[model samples]
Target: MKNEYTDHAWDERDPSPWLALYLDQSTPLPDEVKAAWLRDCSSSSRQFFLPLVRPMARVSMILIQLLKIFLPKRWSHSMLLHRLLALSMNRFVSPEANWLIMRHFHLGSQVLAFVAANAPVAVTATPLTPMVIDDVKDELFLRHDLNLFNFVIRLNKALRTENKELLPVPEPDFSMLRQPDLRLEDMPRGKLNLLDLQSAIEIYTPVYQLLLTDNDFWRASNSLQLDETVAIYCAKILASPEHLVLLNNKHPLVPMTTLYAAYRLVLHGLSSEMLHSLLMRMARGEIPVPARELAKMHKAAEAVAAEESLAP
Candidate 1:
């Protein structure tokens, strides 16, 4: 969760990058920003509007084209519209848009360090760090994973507490990872472009499904774990010797949580590199978990440590 977002828009750099972290994900967002994304998801809007987004966005798309015809090149972008576009893009646009929107956050051990290490201070509007990367390091996708991430954390806790046998994790095909379908240049940047506005309204951000052939038009078929090997990377990010101990599930009791975990993995098609690595380490006895009596105390300590580092 992020600190509460106040309504103060930045005058120099656009704040959409910062806003998207909150608005699109389960993380906390500015009250008003959340309201904008609530578009039709909000309860109040349901009674009067029979889904205003698809139709309204379509109409908005037409109006945007007309505005493009008349509006001068010098003054086409509106800050308000840009803000609204960022707010709406996550729900209304393509997964490319969500992928691109996620481009805002530059991942590193620390934001400034990442910027300094990769970004040059000169010959650039802003210094590009780590060789001027557009995408943040993959570990961040772990934290920005928000509630879905919490699900992972909780599942780990449950599995370990119950002393269940480790489930077999599915092998993910990372070769499938690729760039987004939409063009980055066509997107609305710091300055507004009609295409950007239209994209915000017209495109759809898919959740689980990628190929149109994979699912129906209305239902999305993909999740973050399945989307881009996000979970696998989160596992890699946490694949330290200490983390192996922290998440170890081999306790004294033998129970059904292991079976339940397997059920979840198969049910949702979880790509389980994380679980696999843990299982290997557990089999090796490479990292010792706390004693059964002290395990509860270790769990608390592990939770706190994760709060500060792994999952925070």
Candidate 2:
């Protein structure tokens, strides 16, 4: 991979520049229009209102959790009570925190898909160890937070540039960022009973379905330019032996692997139905290796072997 493509994967200084660029270019709107759209979507004002309601939301969440303990396992998993509690507590939390709770599942799913697509050799060679799953979960959470922070910063900057009166957004009080402990704790743990690949797909499908219903994600998936950029990046990472090793070894910091792969498929013009079918097949170990992709991996491995042979 070229420096530009590979550097962004590890560089934390400027979070998700590639994704940000994709976002900026994909949604073509004039400055004023963008600012207006952001203003309408802004939840900054909710911060001021949150203090008044925070205590109540916290109490409500606690009661819900207590009720869950007394409920049957099936009843507890219904998500009805959870959804209600989340709705009530939503305004009391940081947008990033809420997103982490609500959308991180989807984000993690996308990351898994990327890994499965771009690092097939590594994925097939390695067992899906707990450490690997944890790494994926952590990356998903980090990317979710980074992307949220970047979006807010960019929105504010654009608003300021347009001379729009900034929304009076308060600094997030991390203490108030609470969700159900059970849910939060479960994010890092993959299902252990199933076969490794089956478990990954099972973990991902619910969230993937959730994302399919999300208007924002749907719109982004439709962005041809963004998809192409992401696809190109995925291809680069797929070709990088170091990246393959990191992914196979479950490196702690392999960022945005899944998101890039999901976008690549989206950009490659797979319909949702087709994409889902592909994921199912991939998970079941039924996906045939594309000759070109396989050839690229073989060639890269040969180059590595040759380089090692020459080394003292």
Candidate 3:
């Protein structure tokens, strides 16, 4: 479905080539061509997931604490599987962690059967765009907070293990709270403009569904799509630092990804807003960032930017 050849990091100002390689292409992906694709996806999954385990697991712990505010231990434990799953997928944690999650969910016994039945066998076939996102989006939306929290946790895992080369030092700036030209909530639907939150979900929601249904092999298949989304998200948030501070539990995915993305953007002076609107749409829950963290991030970005500008 997406191109596998292009290399676009999160800070790259122009993510078109990166997006084209993964999102716009329709070239056939038979097994041979798909092999490389799968490898890249594996690499991406590893990159994104490794850094997030501890953070998300901790977040899960805090959530359990918060859940205690309104619910009892039994109910919280009952939904624990969903929580772990949400974090595992959203945070992009390692496959092994997903395995551990399955064990935690008590899905260990069924995992093999699920993988065997769902994973594609070795045979020649045309690999169209994966449908993982479509199959699971509604389920994810229903458990919106868990999903959003999971994304943040997964990001932590990725950051923990990312290569030094992939980490970019961001420019310092006090911009996370800066007002945008237009609020997404205020956008009009009938006008001919870029897609708003609803439209973005309509267009991108299916990707995660596809991811859910994909057998490990197929999971391996759509690796590029995962990376593209991450890179695109990272670049967009850095250019619009204010988006990060504005996140809260109410707008979970948007703010969490934006927050993680801003961190990513800081690693490099490169940045873009191409995906900001799309991210805003994905915000199905709230995300309240601490004011102190917000201030620190701005200072970090501004400092990094100034350093880069002066670099020989």
Candidate 4:
């Protein structure tokens, strides 16, 4: 993979480049090239807002933990405390970043799928060692924060079943944005599970679903060796080779950090694409916005007739 592709993956530098692209308009956006901008918007928003609500999410975490002591682990999440916590997220959190919060699950799933199909059989055939699971779990939690390792196990079961149970997404209205529901549908999380069984899965690499138990999938999770192995396993599976190609020809060293980068990237890319598309429609009289508004878009679209000329 090229440096341009990896340049944006784990860094804070703005991938938006809206000003540059808007002013220049020379950069071509071929289908595959968009991976460079494929940030899962919802996840980024959640992380960004996390600092604001961590105190509460922390409280929720503690309450959930306390319930685990008295009840089955399965029952812990159903406690009033947990329900309130999930509800608070919709109430207090900013509505801006709702792209795909469980993107890691989907990405992780694809990584497993790729490894199962492409890696040597010994890996996919073997169950992950119980001893090693502790190490991988801690590391994955540190990086991805999928609630907790226990929660991830549950999330995985939900994610891979015949009827996929994607981690819940907050349903804040994004009606002002272009076809926000469609954007949600466009996300690749749940769809990535058992990808071959369905239509095209939105991964950077070609992936095939492999029949394997949960243990087989978690081993490449890089027991205490996550850094060295992230790229070897993830390389081009989650982030694309042409876009967010991983460092050292590898992918995320810190998966959640990479996840955040992706979230911002996706949000910016979507906004840019939407703005450009709307400008084009307006310029073509397919929309009713004024010529001045078209001009305001930095001439990203062609000139159009005045608003009065656009008759119904």
Candidate 5:
């Protein structure tokens, strides 16, 4: 299992060894046990039922807009109203749904930040046009024309740079108005490496920073592994009167816990099984052993076993 752990550690750049453990077929569970475990762990049910809530969400949005007419603009945009609406929304949906929704927004913002930082010229040059969507289409039809435009512009610029080594004339399909799908057939025939796009998408420094600075985040992450020592440490931190008061006051637009889950999924491309396992552990509030402590224990046990064998 340990060998399997190291083998699959970087399979998804997942820091959690337990995730790798779950993925390793060498330690297969019985069908019934696996099914039960999956049932306990899975948030895919929220995804399954998400479409059903779209109409309700739309109605809620419309009602909120109508009510805004009676309320002052300041009141309508106030954090109080935002919190009320979020609380109401939370009542109707699972935590998974909230996580999924916020995750999308978080990822979209990350993409925009990436583009702004790496392709400033492309983002600045690209015209921001509003995308039209059919009202009858699914709620997922939400589009960001500006972001898409910037991405295409950047892609084309990269292609042009690559083209300098190849063809004299730029590909006719590469136009600002009509962005080709990022497919091999649609793209210009060249050594157009998407290293920039990859880098932009994979950047999780902000999320990492959040985890590093936050005791609650560490507590939550530790919960995934059900680590008693970390849990005790977290309890001591949380037991502080100042910390308890802060936690009571910490009402965020998006739950930091959900944000962490989403960040891990989006940034690391965590597999569905691993995600399910993580969500389950998080839900149960189990804190795992931190990797450092686990490594130390393993080394100590190995030394003790070696000494016993030498005595024999």
Candidate 6:
């Protein structure tokens, strides 16, 4: 009923300011990280977007054709306005199959909204177009990518199911902190003996589980140590295309990205909240390091490998 919340929708024509503020938090976001992320978004754009994007691009023209062919002569060309509004709203937030439905509704809403705004009261007794109107709404609803929507919806539901209180991180597992000899140079000198491998596993299980199921999760993987096997797997997944799917999964990319950001943060001895916003940014497509982070890690691994190879 009330249109007040519409401004907050992703379809807002000017999301730049919001996006900028959003990215600022993720800032100190390294250039290598930034470049890596842009590359990933670009690749995703090509793979998942371009195919169906064009049809929506020409939705207005298609709407004209539909109205001409299907509508009654007396109804003004504006009858399809409602569909346009609905579509635009849907497309802004939805992903996957439901996108088609949103596209159609956007074109149709323009006509319907126009009619609703301008149509005058009419006393004419001719039967009203009941079936046609219902069909339009029904079709839009049917075309919705319900599965994808449901998944996202369920994810948000799950997150909100609990309070906003932060989950307590367990003690670090000291026994598993043994850093391999090769990392002695590149990595800062630290007590490898202090890390709580088991605790880290418990804290990071959600992320590791997602990586296990993702096919591309290992593409960017770089093994660091036996104890960090899960972290390496996670790095692989984040660098892989599977990141996109996982981002859209039940836990959503928000938490996953946040976890990775936190892992990096922990290494820096930074506060966990340092990554809280960054995780939100990544979920909204501001992933830092992205593939490049994986590349860096890979390079580090290679450097270690090379050193090991030349060992006397």
TM-score of each: 0.22, 0.24, 0.20, 0.28, 0.23, 0.20
Compose the digit string of candidate 2's lDDT tens values, residues 1-312: 012322336446766644344337333322322332232123343334434443444444345445545654443221332343333323233322332334323432343334333431322111121222223333332233344334334444654677653221111112211112223223222222112211222223233323222332333333322322223333343332221221111222232323332323322222222232333333344543243456767789999999999999
lDDT of 4 by residue, 33-137 (tens): 233233222244334544444344334434534554565333321133323323332333222221222222333333333333432222221112112112232
As a whole number from 0 to 100, the lDDT of residue 180 in candidate 5 is: 13
Candidate maximizing TM-score? 4
lDDT of 1 by residue, 1-312 (tens): 222344536555566554454345332222332433332222232333324444654454445445545654444222333344344443344332333334322211122221122221211112122221122232222233342334334444654677652222222112212222333334323322222222232332221111122222111122222312322333333332233332222221222221122122222221222233333343345543223224566678999988889662
lDDT of 1: 0.31
TM-score of 1: 0.22
- In order, candidate lDDTs are 0.31, 0.33, 0.31, 0.30, 0.31, 0.30
- Badly placed stretches (over 4 Å) of model 3 are 1-72, 76-138, 162-237, 242-312
| Shift of residue 113 alpha carbon in model 3, Å | 28
Candidate 4 residue 171 Cα shift, in angstroms, is 40
How many clashes (backbone N, Cα, C below 3 Å) per candidate?
Answer: 16, 1, 64, 7, 10, 34
Winning model by lDDT: 2
lDDT of 5 by residue, 150-197 (tens): 444565576477662111111111112121112212211223221121
RMSD of each: 19.1, 22.7, 21.6, 20.8, 25.2, 27.3
- The TM-score of predicted model 5 comes to 0.23
Clashes of 4: 7
Positional deviation of residue 12's Cα in model 1 after best superposition, in angstroms: 28
**Model 6, 35-80: lDDT tens per residue?**
3222322344434554444344334324443444554444332224
Candidate 2, which ten residues in sequence have the lowest lDDT sum? 168-177
CA lDDT, candidate 6, residue 71 = 48
